[model samples]
Target: MQLSWSQPCSSGMIQLLLVSNLLLWECVVSRPMCLDIGYKKLFLQELFDRATVIAQYTSNLTMQMSEEFDENFAKNLEYKARNSSTCHTASLTTLEINEQIQQTQSDELLKVMISISRVWYHPLEHLVCEVAARKGTCETMLSKIKELEEKNQELLEEMKGILVRVHPGAEENAYPAWMGLAEVRSDNEDTHHFALSNLLHCLRSDTDKIVTYLEVLKCQVIHNNNC
Candidate 1:
């Protein structure tokens, strides 16, 4: 009359919540003595929704930040010193833009920035690499971004290719030319390729999913090892 917990669920819940491990499972088989099954189910659904929202909000904010940083980096007066007083005008314009974005009162946006910095932002100590990387040039950033974007594009294409190869008409109206353009616009190319950079950052952050997948692989290995 008892059920055993899966190892992954155990490890994930432990690491996911450092305070305490899930305790109500024991009661589930004991006639629901210690908990309300309906309320617990609702609570779990709420938790899942919260987790999804956090992930989505983090993704959107990361993209916005990347686009903003790229736009600022790309067409700067410092980089193009020979231009007119455009640099001064840009400075004033940036101030005004910041004022407007600040007016939005988006706490989630700030949290996204914090999460990104926690993972990616580093204070430079030495720069012995090269001049091109010393300054975050458009060409350099763009190239780096293109690498990831190409990878992402290839993955998407492969997915669609496989689906089409299998079903032949699986993606006719589903993925029209406009859909492709809309997806391309989803790239951060518009505002100085910051969108691309943001995507790269997201891919790096989500690399843990790869590890999670590997853990599943490891589990399979261990299970086979025991057998």
Candidate 2:
């Protein structure tokens, strides 16, 4: 799969999304930074909460499909999958993302997270049309990713573009992380079903990563930059 970034979004969409999810953050003037951190945390929690739901839904869906499909075929499929990377076949995996990533390096992480979220929006429209997914589940997944990506953009902007916060002399800039939101091109039903489930698996992993990173940042903020 091609693990790349760069989603084409219009300025108007940004404005509309931001407006819909805007927080009453002006209280920053009255509240201390620590207090304000809670609000941001709450907002992020709200944004990712639906993602958690979608992840669980997909997990259950995959299990159901396994039961519905031939047992031997499913076992063979899983064995082949195990030969490859787990969670997602994309260049980025749960292990790679969680390993060696520091909280202070959030600027770069946010940039990449934004890209990952954007990469899904366009292709999701097409994914919803494919029979690989249950209609309701896929549609919900599509809207939630779009909504949270836009909401996340608001947080990134509020944090001053999340660009300059790199640790004062850090050597590695491994930012704009690889996102492999590849399209489903298979025509066979089984292949398409497998491909769509794979997409959901990756998406669930992505959502978990976003929640993890944001929680780390929330810790840093609430702890007076101690993290």
Q: Top model by TM-score, which number?
A: 2
* Positional deviation of residue 44's Cα in model 1 after best superposition, in angstroms: 1.2
In the order shown, the candidates' Cα RMSDs to the true structure are 20.4, 20.7
In terms of lDDT, model 1 sits at: 0.34
Q: Write the per-residue lDDT of candidate 1 for residues 84-158, one digit (tens) a residue.
A: 212111111111233343332222222222232222211101111111332454564444343333333333333
In lDDT terms, how accurate is model 2? 0.47
Overall lDDT per candidate, in order of appearance: 0.34, 0.47
Best by lDDT: 2
The worst-scoring run of ten residues by lDDT in candidate 2 lies at 166-175
lDDT of 1 at 72: 55
Candidate 2 regions with alpha-carbon error over 4 angstroms: 1-99, 132-185
Model 2 — TM-score against the truth?
Answer: 0.44
In angstroms, give how far residue 17 of model 2 lies from its true place: 54
